[model samples]
Each structure stands twice: as structure tokens, then as C-alpha cells.
Target: MAVSTASPTGSFGPPPPTTAGAIVVEGLRKRYGSDGPEAVKGIDFSVAQGEIFGLLGPNGAGKTTTIGVITTRVRPTGGRVLVDGLDVTQDQVAVKLRLAIVPQRPNLDRSLSALENLTFHAAYFGFSRKARRERALELLEQVGLAGREDDRVDQYSGGMAQRLIIARALIHRPQILILDEPTTGLDPQSRLFLWDTMRDLQSRGTTLILTTHDMAEADQLCDRIAIVDHGEVIALDTPRGLRKLLPSEQGVEVVVVAAGDAGTGTGDPLEAVRSTPGVERADVVAEAEGRTTVRAYGAVDAGDLVDRLKRAGLELVELRQLEGSLEDVFVHLTGRELR
Candidate 1:
């Protein structure tokens, strides 16, 4: 039997010791109206302190709704969400004090300078005039905006604007940082730079909860990931751990070379291979130079596949095993790839 990865284990009672986790969500749920569709069904998970935990799923999978509940932006129909030991419902003010959220979109005031934006945000936390300026300068330097402190935010590039927003979120020194699609439209270089910034924050002991549809981003950054679908958590585990849950631990790729004028003549060699015993799934990934490349998943017997190909009057050009990946596990669990 194939093994299944379950959600993070925990109880729904009051908050645990601070060392247990930075965020505890028990039976978290939300619905737009009394009869409206349930955006977030009953779900539970925990984010350990100082760890970069990821909520990974396609659009409308409840990633954003769950974050809404944790940040107290959307009220939950039923659940217990504790941020740094304070319940989000009863301790909203206290919860807000311990966490900072960087939304999916840029919310900076384009009219204000980068320094001015951070300065105003710090003021809300009650920093004095002198203190706010000092903190803003320090943060600008930290986010690599030291020289651009006085530049208007409207003039900043997308990456620079994102960095400033992150700096603004840190003005009050939040213990937990929540980012929703932190690099949605960033270029490759920008995305890599942002990843470096995330690593730096983790090194400083800031627990991060980020939502992303980018599989590579989640695999590269998160210590643990929760694959949510249809408003429920389908699987949760470390990247390496999740990859192990695939129904087919091994993959096989085969290239067929048909003889003579029979070249590339195939009614469906891919489907024929899928019907073979022990083959979980098969797809024709490519075709070129009178050859068809087939990707087969599962504990496929290479010898048996080669024999079947021979019986089908096809010649074997090449064969190899494919490495397991998280995308395979995700498709197996969710029944669909990320959109």
C-alpha cells in the first residue's frame, strides 16, 4: 500500500508552550455568508517558531482565507488560532502586535518616499519622531534601500517596492511574518534575491508563513509544507518527506524506434504500456525523429516493458529511471496540477 502524508499533529486546546510552535490553528474555518460557500473548511496546522512554513496550493484552495483568519482580517466560523500564545479572536490587538503581514499586492503609498513610508508605519507603533527616523534608516539599510530612502515609492521597481513593503512590515519588529505570494511577478533575478532576503529573516529567528503556487519556491524555502485543496489539508510534511508519498516511488522513461517505413506509426503505445501490469500511469511526453518518448510512473518492470514494446513490433532506442519529485506527489493527492 502507498503511504499517505498526514497533517501536522496537535490538539485544539489552549495554546501550548511558546517553544511548541509560533502559530497554532485548530479546526479553522470560514464562510462568506450563512449560506455562502465555505471558503475554508475545518483545517488545522501549526507553524513552529523560527521555521519557514509554507501553505502551498492552487488558487481558491483556501490559502488566502486561512491567512485572513490568522491575521484577524476575516472572522472564522469555527476555530482556534493562536499567534505567539494569544488567541486571534480574543486577543486581536495583542496578536497584531506580535505579527506583521505583507499582503500579495503592493500597499505602499506611492506619494511618500521609502523612508517616509517606513517612518509613518513606525509612528503607528508609537515611536517618537527621532526614534522613527532612526528605525526607518536602519530598516532601509537592512532592506538595501539606504541610498533610495528619499526616493518616491512610485519610482521604485517592483522588486524594490516589495523590499520596502517588507521593511515596513518589520518597522515594529514583528515576531512572525506572513507573506501572500511574495514574488508573484518578480523576474528570475528578483525572485532569487527575495529568497536570499527570506533566508536572512529566518536566520534572525523570525517565523514565516508564506502562501505560494510556485512549486519550486515552496520546495526551496519551506522547512515544511501543507498541500491544501478544496479547503482542506491533503498532506503536510517536509519536502523530502512529501516526495516519498507518491504512489509510484520510481519512474521510467522509454523511447521507441519503429522499424522501416513504420516510423512513428503508433496507435497509442503510451496507452498500451499503461495497460501493462504494475504500471501506474503512462503518458507520451514527446515525439521526434521517428521516436516516441514515454514517461511511465510506478514500480514498472523495465524488462517487461521492453518485451511488451518488442511484441508491439517497436524497437527500444533508450530507457532510464526518472527521479521522484514533489510535483508528482501533489498531482497524486490533489488530482490536478497547480494552475
Candidate 2:
């Protein structure tokens, strides 16, 4: 789906009584203190119902702050956010009732048993004694904790605790599930399990808003992505659409052993590769033991890159062709330097 990008100075009026999506963020802005830098600045986006929307960016790029506004944890300094057609600031309680958050860090009740944790949360939403009990048990079984429901959460592994947290979030049967770095510390197996769980929830018609730094995870799960940077939405598109923003769709990684004692070729390999036809961008990605890996993206020809590197006095050790990915789109938009 095509996504729109909002300008920094753009003006956005309040949403009507109802909106077309589950969430709407319009010209949102937030500043820490009177003189503090704006954590989020005039951002705009909307998440369709039942879509797995992603807020992707580097650390401190306002992804979390944007989520805070949507969840009503942080007050916006300017503009507005609407959750399920209800203004976040004006309808905080009603909005909260419709949203469930799985925070970046584990916020499970360690003192409570796994089952108690789920039931206790459900109780807040006014579930009756019998209903909460049955719901908790059902969720425990769904999250793979059926036999361990009586165990204290303190004894649970990181993965198990995460699962319990997910179950707890669902106790209220929220309309929108907000996952902030849901799989940060999980092992591959646990991450995959959570991905399956997310898909299951989506299948049941739950809208998901995800904040993540993991490019692969976003690429694999998000229906559409909003790339935020320095408190603004720089780009918004589907994964495939975002990939098209790059100059070329193919990439080549050429690993070369320096032919000289300087640990570099006699000539400038980077310049030579960049000057090669069909090569749009080139960067030295890695270097160790006299081998330097140059990753170039564009309509790159592996054979041409090898021959050019050879002419530059670099001996080819390995060469590999790669498909364009969200990571490349990120680097292209956010720059190659670590923030």
C-alpha cells in the first residue's frame, strides 16, 4: 500500500468523530522540557485495522516516544493522536481500554503465579471472578504455559516470562496490540514463536503496531512501514516499495586480499569500484587478516567488480551477490554512520 509522508511544518487538524484506521497520528510533537529538544516532531501516519504496521528507526529516533503518545503514556506538546477514532488526550481511559501494550522490558508481576498475573490484569478490565479464571487458563494454554500456570513468574525464563506477558496483555482482549521491541532479548526459537503468535493474533483480526530496530523482523512482519528519523517521518511504504527507493536492486560483496604490505591494494579499490559501470554506491564493510570486503549496490556485475578490483591490484578472495533489503533502504535514508 502507498503511504503518505508529512512535512515538518505541515498543519493537521483534529480527526473527525471516526477515522478510517485503528490509529491516527497527526502532526504530533513532543519536547522533554521547556528547552529540551523535541523527542517527536510533527510526525504523521495511520495504521489500518488488522494490519501489522511498523515504526522503524535507529535508537532515539522518536519511535518509542511516538508509541508513548499513542498509548497515552506521554502527553503531546502539540498536535494530536487518535486511537480507534478517540482522541488520545481527550479519551485516555476509553483509548486505554482498547489498547494493550507489551513493553520493551518485561513488566510481568514476578511475585504472582503465571495464572494469577493474567487473572489480576483481567480483573482491572472488570472481568468477573469466573470469567477471569477461565480466560487466564485459556490464555495460559494458548501461550504454551498450560502445565506451568501455577509456577511463580520469578522462576520463568526470559522467553517464558515474555510469553506470560503476552498472555497478560490479551486478558482484556484489546482491539489493538502495541509491541515495543517485543523480541529484543529472545533467542531465535523464541523470536520465531512470538512471530507465529503475532500472525495468529492478526488472523483473529487484531491490529498490531510494532516499534523495532531489527530490520529483518520489520521486513518479515510489517504490512507497511514508517521510517522515522530525528522525530519525523522520513519515508513510509510497504517493504517492497521502500526497497524500490534505492538506486539499484542488486548488491555485490567483493572480498579482496591486499596485494601490498600496507594491507590495502596499490590503488584505491573503493574509487575504482565506484567508477565501475552499474555500481551506484560502494563501501568497505569489513576488514580482517589482510582481507577487505567491499559491498557495492546497484546494477552490479560480480565479474566486472572482480576484474576492476584485480586491475586495482587487489586479489579476489571471495565474491557474493545479494538482494536488496530493508537494511539497505535504512542506510540509504539514515546514512551509513551509527547513530
Candidate 2 stretches with Cα past 4 Å from truth are 1-19, 250-323
Reference-based TM-score, model 2: 0.75
lDDT of 2 by residue, 1-339 (tens): 111111122222121224459998999999999999999989999998889999999899999999999999999999999898899999998898888899999988888999999888878877778877877887788788889999999999999999899888877777788999999999998899889878887876778999888999999999999999999999999998898787665688888876654334556668768978888888988888878888888877777777778777888888886667899999899887777
- The whole-model lDDT of each prediction reads 0.82, 0.84
Off by over 4 Å in 1: 1-19, 251-322, 337-339
Query: What lDDT score is found at residue 305 in candidate 1?
Result: 84
- Each prediction's TM-score versus the true structure: 0.74, 0.75
